[model samples]
Target chain A: MIAPFKTSYLQDMALTKTPLAKASYAGLLIALAAIPLVTGEFYVGELGGLFIFAIAGVGLMLLTGYTGLVSLGHAAFLGIGAYAHAIMLAQGVPFLVSLPLAGLITAAFGIAIGVPTLRMSGLYLAISTLAFGSIIGTVLQKWDKLTGGFDGFPVRPPTILGMKVQGAIGTYYTSLIVLVLVIWVALNILRAPLGRAMVAIRDSEISAQSMGINLAVTKSIAFGISAGITGLAGGLYAHYVRHLAPDSFDILLSIQLVTIVFIGGLGSMHGAIFGAVFMRLLPQAIAMVRDDLPFGLGRTPGLEPSLFGLILVLVIMFEPGGINGRWVKLKHWCKAFPLHRRAASRRQKSYAKSERLR
Target chain B: MESLVGLLQLVINGAATGCIYGLIALGFVLIYKATEMVNFAQGEIMMLGGFAAYTFVGKFGMNYWVGSGLAILATAAFGYLLDAVVLRRVIGQPQFAVVMLTLGLAFIFRAGAGIAWGYDSVAFVTPFTNSIVKFGSGVVLGADNLSIIFGTLVLCGVLYLFFSRTRLGIAMQASSQNQLAAYYMGIPVRRVFSLIWAISAGVAAVAAILLVPVQMVDVNSGIVGFKAFAAAVLGGFGSIPGALVGGVVVGVVEQLAGFYLPTGFQEVTSNIVLLAVLILRPQGLFGQVIRKRV
Candidate 1:
């Protein structure tokens, strides 16, 4: 809770506000890098999956959390990216060239979907995006010549400089590096004026427009950037799985991405990571404990989805700000510790009067 | 001559299925009118209703019509309970939260149905036998399809009368228009919302009853609800008659596309129509253009 004083302009704009914060981040990075060394192959693969989801989560956080656009079709963009990369790789293109090209192709699709949709807001936008996603899924299935239809197609392992990245270890390290690069880029974007504009638009589109922010361009760019990042994650996922299917990128996946973004805490960088890790690891944790339950619940085929839905509902109801919000609150509480006041612990309720009027 | 007969048969089949979609779309429209939140669980509720009816008839050996009526009542009660227990807590939250909650509810409903129904398609017994009715020039209609269309018409007429002539329905309408004013004017807004949810679920149950005879009831039956959602959107989300019209259009289009177009386009035809409508005429055919106040 103690405010850090910045002595210089350089200090003010630094990634971490204090030396302690910087050290913690460095320590966290070291721990992440050391994960594969300590964990078994299965755990390492799960961590890789976690990183891939985190990357996509960050992209969605940009659009939904910061840009205030709720899209239910993000998985479609991911599918597009996955398909694009698979096709490019099939055509004898190298991994390096195909990856970024996949991102660009997905970004173009994002812009194409966004330009017409940017005018609509809230429920309308959500429905349109849902429709858009369904269409992508349909196209992926029907366009069998390109997508291989329902049976799906296998993806070749990504190779760099004539060396193939093999097994969970290589995939984990590659994903970690990609995740770091993505986080760095995202942080830079968040610190820039573009990020501020997105936040402004989220707060009040009318006010943002009145302040000379180009609503159309800013919204489209946000979609493009978000989709591009998500597409990159999709490409990584496809390469990691070595297989692709239309069903893998369905509405359920889109909902899962949204859940991660919300559960991680909206509009925060660390929140996205927290959410991805929580969501990805949750099913495994549930599976581990399923057999030990008192009831005969272990035999149930759909317990995981039921539990997930219950958790989502509970999180939204009790902690709207998600894990990041809870973490900040805990941090504040610990800082106040013995001298903690009830007033200080009370959470702020942000109910808008306008919503009631509408 | 055979192709023309096949086309007529497809249209007839499409119209029958469209009636079910229209009925489910009515559920979406009613809830949206009452609470501005799109209940993604609407489809799941229909699926659950179908399963409930299936259990009543298939397991218990109850008469078809009696089982369906009981199922409708039970589902309505479930809907009321859902509103009271879960949705009531998150009433004032953002639209996204509400929508997500409904989606979560959907997941729960789907999972619950899967657990209860064992993830298998079950035959739903109807009062009418599956006798084929031959018409002019070899154009044929199944008895179940005829019943589906007739059932839809009866449900529509009843709903129309209830909404137009009843005091409770008038109050519900008042609450939808302006909740605060309705509350101020001595209307029980909370109860009205609960009733709306109940009615929506009941309508969905009817749709399920009608649909079950044609297609076997299964866990994946909820998938059809998305097409119903598309129909609702195409009809201008909150419009009652629009839902019916949109449902028919979507159903016909889907049938035509599945028969005429390359394989798999049928599954996505509604979504394609929905997207086109959203982009070209977001207000829908019957919906008024919504203006945001800065």
Candidate 2:
């Protein structure tokens, strides 16, 4: 992965360091594009769900991973976006317009929630977000006229350029396009000075402030952008699913999104994609092998959740760096094959470890 | 006079429910005091305890008291094992990771309970039958409500005595204040940590037992833990007495909101109070203000 010496500043600041990396990335994009054509209808739908989750995962990574803000209310924002998009579409608004508008509305809500809670950090902030999420959930259930109450409401499939985006393939492409655009935006943000500011704040708010970074502005902006991105994903999800229920975006979904970020590898943009794909495919994999297993374990009501919980615990205990961390290590080890030094191939300390009790 | 009586009834019911919240909040405070880690699984632990008691009394045909006692002991053992096996390894990990781990554990516990005891809601049998006791001109209290209030009071008093007068409790407090220093002084810090988890789990079991008698036992009963969490935060996360006061406050506010406001406000009332307290007064009523240091 090491790159040749760059003669110019532009070359040094390039997204991909080497031509091999660039070619591989291009190949990945083409492979992703061809997935809908080659895969079955069922898999196309799964990929749609994957892309939606990836969008949300990337959003969460920006806040929790880079900005060091833990939010248990992400699903609430998603709920807001889903409802907003649905409402707008019902009113004859275009899909493209409704998507960004839903994002903007969710961003406003995010800022409103963030402004009050951002002053606090760690567990307190997490609890506050949890409270906010529950409150939003309650609102979604009670506001019957707007949200259709517990029964939920129908979401009309989105149309593009006067043609209906029909079926699983259509939705998959729409989600894929959105996912690609979001990834691009996210990558650019990370490369920018603002991303560095966020990382600095995450590392040490006090030191970041001493360095003249506005804590309030940076944190609030992060919250808004994160919520906006998650909201867009929600908009996409609503159209894809063609239905909306308050229960669909509960605290469990929020937990799942966070799990995606963590299992993929926190603070890495690519981790979101890897985590989302793995998590989305996991239940399907289980379902495929469920009948073969002895004792009918897969038929249990909470089996999937229990498995997810076990995975989360295992990941945190053994691989705090997650799947991406393992990938990086594997690459390093492979590069130094035959003389691979475990110590030398270890990942740099990027994440903040908790302080031991005095 | 009838309206006044209705209000009093609501207040009484609120207090009873609040006591249950206080019991759960007390678990949060105990663990936080010892380790500064919020056990997100506290509610799920409560739910499992209730299921355990149900299985003992209903399925095994055991006496109510015996079943309750067994449930508490079992949950305590589970808690100890949880801390010793899983949580001990995560001692110096980030707060976010620990919190998420507890959340994951909560999911596992809830799912396990659901699988073991079907998702159906079953009436929990208590020794005392449901009876209404009239007081003064119009105030009437359910026997169950009175028992819950009194039981919580007794538990709190016992806990207070344990922390103040017992040797092991004092040792736990010493370890919580300074683990390394306590270790230097020959206290078993790791053992203390496990004991705290056990005590917290046991308290959660008591809350669940009391709760199941009032309503019914179901897999989703752990949702009450979220309200208790709010109560813990509202009262001051690490303060024992604050948990009680906070629980009462949240319960009363929730009942009043449900009574006076539009329908469905009750569900969100505790969260609203939680958010308000967290934003307006992060230190809480009893919590000491934490000053930031460079």
Candidate 3:
């Protein structure tokens, strides 16, 4: 049954999805493991923040991109996660134990609040989440006893294994490890029955339900998983910044996360990476421009949002599939241009023959 | 009873706030109803209108009456231009694209205003600054609040009349109800849409004019878009009366929540109200419960 193109599993020699793929993936992992060893503290610190944001973005990609749930309020979960961690650290709880607990708590909280998501879709869901986010932000400011109000609460760095882990390198490695684990979990989820169920749910809730997929459970689990991931990111953010403020979890950050998921490409892991890196780097890039540009452009902070908004709009209008999608399409077209043209002509000929038969 | 007077005041305040919400929601509904696009820019438009009016009188040395009129017209024109230049091009895109585009527009408008004007909040002086009317008991209505209530009433009344009585408004309404059917009936659907866009913009300007008196004029004033959006949802997205009721409910709830709730609970309360409404009655108070068929 093997055709010329189908030479067993050996012929399926893609860079991913095989034993060879695992080896290459492991090799890539080793290289990444060595990145902090050679990189400067400033670069590692920035990358650390980017990694944290990417983890949050991955959660969003699962929820919004894959499950088709629109949340303009994931930042609130991040805030919740951060506060959980901050509160824990303030009480002298070790960071290692607190982080996972924060994530679990966030997941539970997400499911509790996401109850409305079972019935609502689109704008209703968006508004519902947006409202929740705004409320969290306000409470973070107003709940002085717990959140420490707008000025924010201080967090001490966690000591681990009798070693004082202070500095950007430790933070970067911590963030990097978390990001790798998140990526691994996300990849596994994408491949699992639950992941396919999410995609099916996204594509058609009615069809999935008719196929005996429990809508409520699936949706709630997706929300929970997404929130847990975001919470992990949040805990990291709190520890990294060493401060937790209400303003840190405003609606704008939610929008920023949404923008990253969209611009990175919906439903693609690579897109999440692309989006996180670009979004993090873009501001710094703009800041670089500000530093280097002539006097007129100097010392301006408002330009960043405007430019960001402009890019977001442009991307939505011109590139609905995002950077990853565009890149994939480009590569595909480049690799098969000639064969695609010949096949198109052949298909047209067959179509004409079929039309005559009809 | 004095309680009756307080209830009346709450009702008055709610309705007045509802008027502003309705007007702003009218911006969302106008665009959504006609083109199936939710204009996140509506809130920013309100901010711009408020800021424009503030500047005209405060900075440009224009009279209050002139500034108010000019601000409305200018913002209406800006709305029309946005429709023509940007929104129209994005027709037939995914609803998400349209939504995010407007969201981006909101950021641009708010931040742009911030850049143009400093981040500091400024007071907007309405023409009826110091006027007050004493109710029979101790309840006194500030002239500013009274003007807002009366002005919104007049605007809404006129809008209702325009939609029902005027031919152009009727055409716009028909278009919003069903574009294909209206077009088949030989209505200039696109023109009516443009007109609605203009009218909605004008309505937002009216809301800005009314609201600026009470709230500080700043980039944050645009955040009222969500409050107004909540009002729209509470009332019913497409229903005029629903928009009014929704806005008032949101405003009064906000006020009451502010007054009675814990120090920082007002913000959370509004969202809780919205979530409750959605879970309990997603169709909203006055909205038609649409059932889709496969």
Candidate 4:
């Protein structure tokens, strides 16, 4: 293989380095845009759900993947966004206004949780977030007057400017637009110093701090942005679910979001999409084969969770780099087909040490 | 005086349940101390123990004491295999990898138990079941509650003597403190860690056996693992005595909250307490703040 000739730094550092890259990306976008027109409503709706989850997955990827913060309670942010959007829409806010507003509200909640967590990291952060999620869940459940409590809350049909987003197509287009916007923002963040700082913090918090990064402020911002993005996804999700159940945003959903970040490939935006695709497809794949199995395993109530658990364990043990990582490895292998050694550039990372280990 | 007796009964009941939580938390802390890995499936292991006891005693009509003993040994063996086969592989991975691994294992365990025992709750007759003890001045407590307290005390005492007096226990402690140094000193570090896991699981089994008369064993009974997680954190993660104290505090507070607080607050007391502890004092009551150069 030969390297591409680069005339300038601008050419060297361009997001789409080659004409082939640009063309392929454009082709992918075009395909996605035209997809709803050709596909059936069921698929379109499912894809819309995919987009919504992608948005949240990307949001969580920013925090857990890039920033190295594990949040076991991200579903709280999703709920906050959904509930906020529903409440605002119910009170006569326009769709465009309500969505961003919902994002802002959830960001505030994120900061609220994040500010207290300045001194916390890893296990403590995870545990606190778990507790925080349960607290918020209870609030959503018991706060009957506002969230409608156990009876569930209804979301009004969102109208942008003067047009109402009515069905599968509207949700599909809206969510796709949001996903694209989120990806754009996330990419821009990656290019910026902030994203570098986040990566640095993930690699070594002490080193990041020594390098003059404002640990508190940067962590808060990461939390806010991550939550805000998840909230936006939640607003999109409100449309997908129609009637909002408080229990929907739970540890399981939070785990699903983390699964997206893990299975997709940490530190890469494309992982979010790949992860979202897998997340949506697994259940469908199971459903397709549910009736054909020989044993009563087909009728097992907890099959989905166990399958998820199995996938998680397998991925961690064998493919910790996730699907995106595997894709990169495959690409590398193909590019260097004859000369590629198994040990080439396999960076061995150490475990996260507790204080005692340190 | 009557109210005092009522309060004593509540405290006693709370302590009984607290003992269970402590034992489970002890399971968590033991592994955390030994391997720097938190086993999120500790409660699930307990649930397995309960079901195994049910199979032996309830289904096969075996003697309760003997059945429970076998169940403990079985669970301990399972824990050993779990660490040897699954957990040992993730030795150098990120901390979250282990955390997620155990959580996944919890899911698999629950599903496995569901498959083996069915999803319904099961129980067996115990010596302490349905028996009550009367104190002077109209104070009465369930024999199950007394058994749990007495059993926990005896277990703790036994554990203390073993850790201090026995060479294997000392080896386990040394391995937990510094794996490399212990390995250099002729300790089979991996085997010691596995033994610690076995002991942890055995403790969980004891808790499950003690809890059988109080509550039925179901697949979801592993939900207690979350609360026990809270208990372990409250006890400062790695402190043995602190874990017990924290569990008792949480259990007593829970009982008190259920008795006095509004209907909804009862369910969230431990969560709130956990959050409060995490935010205010991350090291917990008995834990030292270990500041690393990293």
lDDT against the true structure, each candidate: 0.86, 0.87, 0.80, 0.89
Residue-by-residue lDDT tens digits, candidate 1, A3-28:
34568977756777778988998999
Docking class of 3: acceptable
In CAPRI terms, where does candidate 2 land? medium
- TM-score of the second chain of model 4 compared to its true counterpart: 0.98
Off by over 4 Å in 2: A1-13, A345-358, B292-294
User: So what's the TM-score on candidate 1?
Assistant: 0.94
Q: After best superposition, candidate 1 residue B90: deviation in angstroms?
A: 1.3
For model 2, residues A1-358, the per-residue Cα lDDT tens digits are 2224579987756777789988998998899899877879998898898999999999999998899887899999999999999999999999889999999999999999888877766677689889899889989998899999988988988888898988888888888899989988988887788988999988877789899999988999999999999999999889777889888788988899999988998888878988998899889899899988777677888888888898999998888878988887787678768787767645344432323311
Error of 3 at A241 (Å): 1.2
On lDDT, who's better, 3 or 4?
Answer: 4
Q: List the candidate 1 regions with Cα displacement exceeding 4 Å.
A: A1-14, A342-358, B1-3, B134-137, B292-294
Better of 3 and 4 by TM-score: 4
Instruction: Count backbone clashes in candidate 1.
Output: 0
Model 1 local distance difference test score: 0.86
Candidate 4 chain B least-lDDT 10 residues: B285-294
Please name the candidate that would achieve the greatest lDDT relative to the true structure.
Answer: 4
Error of 2 at A158 (Å): 3.2
DockQ of each: 0.48, 0.51, 0.33, 0.62
TM-score of each: 0.94, 0.94, 0.89, 0.96
lDDT of 2 by residue, B1-294 (tens): 899899988998899899999999999999988887889889889898888888888789898989889999999999999999999887666788888999999988878887788889876668644877889896888888888888899999999899989999899889877776898999999899999999999999988888776878888888899999888988888789999999988888899999899888888999999988877997787986654353
List pairs with backbone clashes in candidate 1: none
What are the RMSDs of all candidates, in order?
Answer: 2.6, 2.8, 5.7, 2.3
